[model samples]
Target: MSDSAVSTSRALFERASVVTPGGVNSPVRAFNAVGGTPRFIRSAQGAWLTDADGHDYVDLICSWGPMLLGHAHPEVTAAVQAAVGRGTSYGTPTEPEVLLAEEIVGRTPVEQVRFVSSGTEATMSAIRLARGFTGRDVVVKFAGCYHGHVDSLLASAGSGLATFAVPGTPGVPASSTALTLVLPYNDRAAVEQVFAEHGDRIACLITEAAAGNMGVVPPDPGFNGFLAETCRTHGALFVTDEVMTGFRASSRGYWGIDGAQEGWVPDLMTFGKVMGGGFPAAAFGGRAEVMGHLSPQGPVYQAGTLSGNPIATTAGLTTLRLATDEVYDHIGGVAETLKTAAAEALTRAGVPHVVQSAGTMFSVFFTDPAHGPVRNFEDASRTDSTAYAAYFHAMLDAGVYLPPSAYEAWFVSAAHDDRAVQTVLDALPAASQAAAAAQGGAR
Candidate 1:
C-alpha cells in the first residue's frame, strides 16, 4: 500500500524494458492509461491475483476476458496437466482437436471450423476466407470494435484503440487499409451508407456482435438486425468477431445472444478467449461454402504449426464442457450483483455512470448524467476517462482490480461468488468518491 512496497514492480518494469517493447508484451499492461506502476502478478487462483509483493486483489479484468472459469481452475488445470503428459505440440492432428471442433460446431450450429493460434489469427484468416469466397477487397468494421491486431482490422479500433494513438498502425500500408472502411458502432445508417457505396466491392462487414472493446457498449436495439439484413441485401458476407465475447458472454458467444434472439446468423464467426481456457487457441468458421475456400479444399491458404495444438485443445475442450447452463446462470447472477452494487454506489455518490453488460462482461463508464446513454463509439468517447483512471486507482488500492483503461470491459467468471461481488461492492463507494473528487464534484 506504500510507495516503497510498490517500487518492486517498478524495478521489474525497468528490467523488462531492456528486452521488451514498452517494458511489457502488451501495451495496456504497461499501465499508461491509469498512470501507475503495473502490478506484476505472481499467480492467480479462482477470482484473485497475487501480486509480486503478495498483495491479493479481486481480478475483474480476468486476463482480458479469458479466465471465465477463473485462473488455474481445477478441471482446466487437470485437463492441461493430462495433456502435457502426452505432448505439448504434435504438428499433426489429435483427438482433442476433433473433439474441440465438434464441441464448438455443436454449440454454435455453424458449419466446419478451422483452429488457429490466436484471436488475431482467427480474424485474419476469417477476412481472407471472406475475400476468397466473395472475390471482393473491401471489409467494413465498426469503430471501437477490436478484431485483434491483424493489420487491416486494426484501423480506428478500440481496446488498444486510443492507446496506440495512430489512425492505423505504421507497419500496415496505407493502401492495405484503403479498403478497410471504419464506421461508428450502433449506427445503422452509417453502415448502410458505406455499403450502398461499396457493397459490391466489399467482401464482408465484420463486427463484435456486442461491442465490448469500447467499454462493453451493447448494440443499439435493432442495430445488429440492420447489419445482417443490409449485408444480405448487398451480397456481402456478415462476419461476427466474437473473440472476446465468445464463451464468456454466454455458452454460444455474443452472436448466439444477439442472433438467436434476433433470428439472424452471420456468414462467419471467429472465436477465442474463453474457448481456449487461457491457452493460445482460437477458431474461425461459418457457412460451408465460405470455409471450404481455405486450404486442401480451395485456393485460399492458411496454416499454422500450432493450429490445433493438442494441449491447447484439451484445455479448451475441458473449459467449454464445464461451461454448462448452471455455470452460466451462476456467472450471470454474479454479474448482476456487481452491476447493482457499482451502480448503487455511483448513484449514491452522485456520480454519473452507465453499466453496460452482455452475460458476464460489463464496464462502468464515467459520464455526465445528461449523457444518459452510450450506443456507439462517438457516445463512448464522450465519457470522462480521466475520472475513470482515478476510480481505477482507488479500486486497485482497495484490492479490486479493474481494466486500467475505460475502453476495456470488466469480466466476471464462474468463480466470482458472493465474496468477490461483496469485495467490489464494498470498494465502490470510495472509488466513486475518488472519481467525483478527480472531476471536481462535476457529477
Candidate 2:
C-alpha cells in the first residue's frame, strides 16, 4: 500500500484516538507491536478486507477466528437480517439460543450450555460455576493460555512453583489473583506439582483447548486427557477455553481431534469465536450434572440482560449449521499449502524460523528450528519479534494481512479461495526477504 493510501487510515486513527485509548477498541489493533498506521477497515467481503483507503488485502486474521465462513457470508448475513426484523433482543429466553445450544451439545461433549455475549463473559462464568460446584476458592491456569481478561485468569506466574499468581495488569488487584495459580503451558511436571501441593483447595484448572494467543502451541500427546484425569482425581473441574478454536479447529473444535478419540471428556468447556459466526456470542457448558449447579437450576447466580440475543444466536446458529466437514477440509488444505509455501520462502531467504500448529490453527515463529517446536510461552517468547514486524509489514504491503502481533494464530477461512491462497503464496518470498534483511543479513 502507498503512503497516499495510508493517509486516510492515519487520519481516521487520529480521530479515533481522541475518543478511544490507543486509537483502537482493541490494543493489538493499534499496530504498536508492528509499528505502522493500523488500517481502518471500511468493509470486508469473502476473504478480503477493504481499508478506509480502499486497498483490499487477503484477511488472514479472520476476525481472530470468528469468520470461519469469511466476512459477509450470504447465509449468515441473511439469517441475521431476518432475525433483526423479528427484533434484535427480547431480554428474555429465545428459540435461536435453544437451537444453538442444542447444536453445540450435539457437536461437542458439552451436554448443556449457557450463552454469554463475549468470550470473557463465557470464561468468567465458567470459572464461577466451577467454584460453585466444587466449593473451592483456588483457580489454576497455564501461562500464555489466555482465557479472556477475567481478573483471576489475567495473571502472571508467581516466583515459585505452585505459588499464587500476581496480577498481570494494573487494574487487577493482588487479592483477585490471590487464589490463582499460574503454571507453564505443556509442563506436566509443573501441573503435577501444583495439584499435589494445592489440589484440595483448587476449584478448577482452565486451559485453551490448544494455546493460540501465544502462537499455536499444541498440547503434548495425551496432554489434555491427562489434565482431565488429573482434575477428576483432584475433584476439580477441567475447563478447556476454546474461545479461539471452537468449530474452527474442526467441526467439534480441538476436542474432536483429541478427546473424542481418546475417550476422556472435560468437566467443563468454554466456547466462542466461530460458534458466534461473526457476532459477539459465546457459551460455556459441560455435563448436565455439573451445569445443574448454575442459575435457576441451583443457586450459582449468573444472569445477563442480553445473554441470548436473537440476532447473535441466529448468526451463530446459521454459521454452525453451514460449517460442514467440507468447510474444515477446505480450510485445512489451504492452511497446509500456505504453511509449506511460507516455510519454503523463509528458508530460501535464509531466515531461521519455526512454524507451530494445533490442528488447522497455526503461527509461524521467527525463531530457530534448532530450538525445536515452541511448546510453551517461554519458547514462543524467543520468536524474533523485530523480524516478525518486518515480515508483517511486508505481507501487508504485498496485500496479505496477517495478525499484527507475532504471538497470535493466523486464522484462515473456508472463503479463502485459490485467488486468496495465491495472494498469500505470492507474498511469502518477498516478506521472508524483508524479514531476513531486518535480522541483519539473516544472522
143-238, model 2: which lDDT tens digit per residue?
999999889988999999889999999999999999999999999999999999999999999999999999999999999999999999999999
lDDT of 1 by residue, 1-443 (tens): 56677787888988998989889998999989878889999999999998988888999989898888889999899989989999898788899999999999998858899999999999999999999999998888888888889888767643332121224777876656767888778777777677767779889999998888888988877788788889899889999888998888889888778888889988999999888889999999998888888899999999999998999999999999999999989888888888888999888888788888976788888876577777888778877777888899999999999998888898888889778888888899999998887774222
For candidate 2, which ten residues in a row score worst on lDDT?
434-443
Task: Give all candidates' CA lDDT scores.
Answer: 0.86, 0.92
Q: Which stretches of candidate 2 lie over 4 Å from their true place?
A: 440-443
Report clash pairs, candidate 1.
none
Report how far off residue 408 is in candidate 1 (Å): 1.1
Native-to-model Cα distance after best TM-score fit, residue 171 in candidate 1, in Å: 2.7
C-alpha displacement of 384 in model 2, angstroms?
0.4
In the order shown, the candidates' Cα RMSDs to the true structure are 3.2, 1.4
Clashes per prediction? Answer: 0, 0
Q: What global local distance difference test value does model 1 have?
A: 0.86
Clashes of 1: 0
